[model samples]
Target: MSLLNEKVISSASEQTQAVLSFVRAWLRGEETFEIHTSGSTGAPKRIWLTRSQMEASAQATAAALGLEVGMNALVCLPVQYIAGRMMLVRGLVLGLNLIVVEPSSDPLAALPADLSVDFVSFVPLQMKTLLDVALVADDDQLSSEARARALAYRRRLEAMRAILVGGGPISPGLEAQIRQIAAPAYHTYGMTETATHVALRRLNGPQASDRFVPLPGVETGVDERGCLHVRGTMTGGALLQTNDLVALQPDGSFIWVGRWDNVINSGGVKVHVEQVEATIETLAAEQPELGLARRRFFIAGLPDERLGQRVVLVVEGAPLAEDQEAQLLRALIRALPRHHAPRHIQYIDRFAETPTGKIERSSTLKLLE
Candidate 1:
């Protein structure tokens, strides 16, 4: 039976079959399911989650986002992951009409010309890709059909009620582009353990913010190490400790700093790798000619004789020219502390990524060997 319209269909694509299989299982009252983490920080591990937990998550999201029954919810992420699975759960639990599509760099390209969904989620890369297509300049060389498709995608996006971007950080350049769009977009923060995002920060419109506000029934706290602690109905009332460093606000909203494990100690000076990366992103956004924002990159620490560990910038693809490298370093030096500036810049043909498309920092660094 097709879960889309409740019509039994004779054939289905592999991705559609996977979606239906999960929906059927859920409808038949499946209790507990095993899901894997994205392995962005370390190795991917399987964890068990109860049906009640997933339901709580979905309901909380619906309440927070004002999702109602009969709304069209797009499920374009890989269903094997928590983010995708929760989309299906929302559809089944809240009676939303599921618009299923196989995951891709541009999922909206697969939708029908006039189709408009009320809710959807994307990784930062996918949102960036969609924005690129939607904002394609008229003077840019392209076929008439390509231009028509771009227009269709823009209309579909503008008609959406809410857009959720998660699974990774949104670059400053991309966030600036998001502000130009009419859709209500949000940046989400959560992990596999929480069944998806437990908090959301508006990325566009007047309500946009840097802090992530927790959904109803979710409570957040900071540990002794300044990492985050999450406790809520979705967590089954047990607190879940995380390695993410954050500044918990007095109002309960919090600002994400970086991962505790990704901190670099160079010459006894602690530097947050994400903070350096954020600075680079801002620089790239402000000055696009540097071309840093167009590439995939990360900041890491390497063993050093005197400093114990030295911060280095690892970028994907070809190395920058000598002059360009010097300019980037000068910019970093002007923007960051002396020790926070990358001591060296390294390049790789491609970055290692988790199945869910997050950069595998540790594994990718090993590629330099």
Candidate 2:
């Protein structure tokens, strides 16, 4: 075989090397392999997964999406993360022609204009970047040359049959933009423990669902704490209880409530951080002072002498001025019920995020300490 046929990738980064090593090992009949969790809620840890498990996951995903052999898939996420790694697994097992690209906030920028991408996966950050670029393309104020490049980006996205957005929350603004795309964009829900997503909520189209419905062969319900639990072939039939709170419906679909860890028991009232954060997202788009449309924020619990724990709002970026703070507080109070109101406000120069782009609510709040 020629040197090129030897399957050597020269000048590749360490991450790409790791990806190749793992995939090669699996292809070589390796049974069990260790993978790390992104650890958005806790310390990172390694766990073993089998080739059979990954293959089963890939088949499920392919079946769910109606992916055929030799279809094209673009992979732009870090190969280390589960979402990114699964894209590779899907390519190998589902016989996709994988077009791998370096991790970026704007991976589409590197693609060929005429490339036919059937499916693609991105975090909310990447989606936001693409949406922002698409907006610029439609703006008549831009130079013709600039608009042409941006139009190419938008066209590439519209050409995809499916787009999967996960790894973090999709803001309302991004979701609205996704609706305008011709492709059916979906919000995926799952973690490394589940070998990627076991359920999907369509973000666009007439069949768009408010609840996350599990893929075939997956079952979902809530544990005693109202946290989500999975029992299915995807989970190896072992019940995998998650920290995510959800309203598990009788129809086997689930409405994600929030995270139990971020819930605050303030004066015996239960306050969900995720719910408040969703409200904040809406306000960010409406109010100029909050600027949360581009900024990030989360609700946290702080110890209080009387209430035991008080709901606190933690915003990303420099601290707000007294007037700005007051405006934010008023907006938040108006939207949230009395018990759900944040008792305190804090700011971080930058919010801590997991490698996969999930906001580390607890650790980010710790920065204020």
TM-scores, each model vs. reference: 0.94, 0.94
RMSD of each: 2.3, 2.7
* Candidate 2 error regions (>4 Å): 1-12
lDDT of 2 by residue, 1-369 (tens): 011111222323665676688678867988877788888879888877777777888888888888888778887888787888888888888888777677888887666566678899999989988888876786878999989978887878787888999987777778888888778889999888888899999998887877888988998778789999887676787899899989889988999888788788999999887788888888888887665667777887888999999888888887788887888888888899997988578888887877767777767877777
For each candidate in the order shown, give its overall lDDT on alpha carbons.
Answer: 0.86, 0.81
lDDT tens readout by residue for model 1, 203-248: 9898999999999999999999999999988898999999999999
Strongest candidate by lDDT = 1
Predict model 1's lDDT versus the native.
0.86
